[model samples]
Target chain A: EAGVTQSPRYAVLQEGQAVSFWCDPISGHDTLYWYQQPRDQGPQLLVYFRDEAVIDNSQLPSDRFSAVRPKGTNSTLKIQSAKQGDTATYLCASSSDSYNNQAPLFGEGTRLSVL
Target chain B: GDSVTQTEGLVTLTEGLPVMLNCTYQTIYSNPFLFWYVQHLNESPRLLLKSFTDNKRTEHQGFHATLHKSSSSFHLQKSSAQLSDSALYYCALMRGSALGRLHFGAGTQLIVIP
Candidate 1:
């Protein structure tokens, strides 16, 4: 079984630029999540979805950050007009259980640097 | 809301010494799942140990953690530290009702020296 896969392992962007990160969850996984992890800090939940419906996105920055899992198996996280403060690693995780009763498996993450 | 706290920012210990990382959590739900994740350099975070039962010990890869609902604590421990154990550890909590969302601590970086 393959693990969660994320694209563009790394990215470098300037202020006011737009960037998008992609994620593919594990097979048969019903729950997917996106997290932002800054240097020396823990992973913070940005948003999550169960199948095609969003479960929670309260932590997401609506003005600049947006995420969607249209078909429920893949997801895309986009940042509009990025700022220096947006520099961080974006992690994608998935759980096999629909209710997320199991521990999540994480991807290598996309390291983004905004200058 | 659920939250986790790791009191230690960094812990340095020599090989063969005991290791202990403190973790505490706050949550309104009585049944909360606690998890410990380890991330090595340039790697993704993986689950080290997890437990939802109170007063029960969960062990994985020579590391152990016991969830104590009475005190709202779940501390990671190991008898002897190894150089390979150097990494960042995060303690996380998930409310019983809100299963998929995880609230993580700031993290503790453990450096095991020879």
Candidate 2:
């Protein structure tokens, strides 16, 4: 069974540049999540989806960030105007069931650096 | 809203010594799921242990934690620290609604010295 997969293991961009991070969750998983983890810090939830429907996105920066899971299997998180504070690792995770006691499996994450 | 708090940012211990990392949480929900996640260098975080039952100890991979509703704490502990135990530990909380969202605390870096 393959785990969650994320593309572009790393990304570097200048301030005001836009970037997108892609995530392919585990097969048959119903829930997908995006988290931001700064250096030496824990992962912070940005958004989550359950079968193409966004469950929560209150933490997402509405001004410059957007996420979509059109097919309910793959997800993409976009940053319209990256800032230095956006320098962090973007992690993708998925779970078979949100209501169950099972923990979500995480991806390798995309390390982003904004200059 | 749910939040997790890890008081120690870094903990250093000698090999064969006992290990304890403090974790406390705050939430409006009565039944919250508590989790311990460990992340090695260059690796993503993985679940170490989790429990929703109050006062019931959950053990995995030589580590154990007990969810205490009275104190709102779920501390991670081990009998003996090993060199391989060096990693960043994060305590996370999930609300009782089973929404599968996690609120993580500032990580605690555990360094076991030989």
Candidate 3:
């Protein structure tokens, strides 16, 4: 089976610039997640959804970060007015189903560098 | 208040030696699921082991981890380290009773020097 896919493998942006990262999850997966991993750190959960409706996004920075899964299969995580701290890998992952039973399959991730 | 802590930032070991990476967690919710994920260079992290029951060792690909609820720890172990086993390992917790978000530790980089 095809794994989760992410676009724009690498992105370099000036501070305050806007960027969007896209993700296409595995077929039939119901849970999609977005995580941010700073250098030398583990991936931190930013937001997650079950078929489009966000389940948790408390960790997402509302002022500059926004995400959407309009159709439940694909997702987009956007960052406006990016800052230097936003330089990291944006990883998108998906699970087979909810109830927290299935292991997540991750995408290669979008490496973002904010200057 | 829920978080994970992996004690080792980096561990360098010779091949064929026993391996161990420390992990601990704190969560108020009941019935948490512990997980270990391995990430190779330039690749997305993959699940290596997960457990919900205490004292039962979960093993995969010769790597194993036992979750001890009493100690709030899940330490990953391997009998004989292989060069291929060198990677970044992350410890995570899944609060099954709550929203079930995967909370992760800062990861341990294992380098198996041959």
Candidate 4:
């Protein structure tokens, strides 16, 4: 079975530029999540959706970051105006709704660098 | 609020030595799932082990962890380390209600020297 897939494995941009990351989760998975992982740090949850409905996004930066899962299978996270602090890896993960014991699987992540 | 804490940023040990990576968590949910994920260089993080039952040990790939509700800890341990064990380890927690939303710790980098 194919795992979660993310496009543009790496991205470099200047400050104030906008960028978008895409994610295609595993088939049949009901939950999708976006996380930011700074260098030397663990993944931090940014936003999550269950079947096209956002479950939580309190940690997301409302001013600059936005995410959507229109079809409940694919997702896109957008940064309106990137900053130096936004230099980090953007990870996408997914899990099924079958059981609570199921663990989320992650993608290779998009390594973003803001100059 | 939910959070995970891994105290060790870097741990270096010779091959065949015992390994212990500290992990602690705080969450308001009564039954939270705890997970250990390992990431090799240039690779995605994969599940190492996970457990929700308090005090019941879960083992995988020679690594083991036990979730202790009394102390709010789920420290990862291995009796002997190998060179192939070198990688980044993260401890994470998810509230029962928030199925896929995981709160991860700062992570611990383990370097096993042969």
lDDT (Cα, tens digit) per residue for candidate 1, span B1-114: 678899999999999999999999998899888999999988889989988899989999999999999999999999999999999999988876455488889899999999
Candidate 4 off by > 4 Å: none
- Candidate 2: fraction of native contacts reproduced: 0.66
Give per-residue CA lDDT, model 4, range B25-81, as digits (tens): 998898899999999987779999988899999999899999999999999999999
Summing lDDT over every window of 10 consecutive residues in candidate 2 chain A, give the lowest-scoring window. A95-104
| Candidate 1: CAPRI quality band | medium
Which candidate number maximizes TM-score? 1
Per-residue CA lDDT of candidate 3, range A2-98, in tens?
Answer: 9999999999999999999999999998889999988777898999998989999999999999999999999999998999999999999998655
Task: Tell me the interface RMSD of every candidate, in Å.
Answer: 1.8, 1.7, 1.9, 1.4
C-alpha root-mean-square deviation, candidate 4: 1.6
lDDT at A16 for candidate 4?
A: 99
Could you tell me which 10 consecutive residues in candidate 3 chain B have the lowest summed lDDT?
A: B92-101
Q: Rate the local accuracy (lDDT) of all candidates.
A: 0.91, 0.92, 0.91, 0.92
Work out the TM-score per prediction.
0.95, 0.93, 0.92, 0.94
* lDDT per residue (tens digit) for residues B1-114 in model 2: 678899999999999999999999999898888889999998899989988899999999999999999999999999999999999999988874566598889989999999
Q: What is the TM-score of chain B alone in each candidate?
A: 0.97, 0.97, 0.97, 0.97
Give the Cα error of residue B70 in candidate 2, in Å: 2.3
All DockQ scores: 0.67, 0.66, 0.65, 0.72
Report each candidate's C-alpha RMSD, comma-separated, in the order given. Answer: 1.5, 1.6, 1.8, 1.6
Please identify model 1 stretches exceeding 4 Å from their true place. A98-101
| Off by more than 4 A, model 3 | A98-100
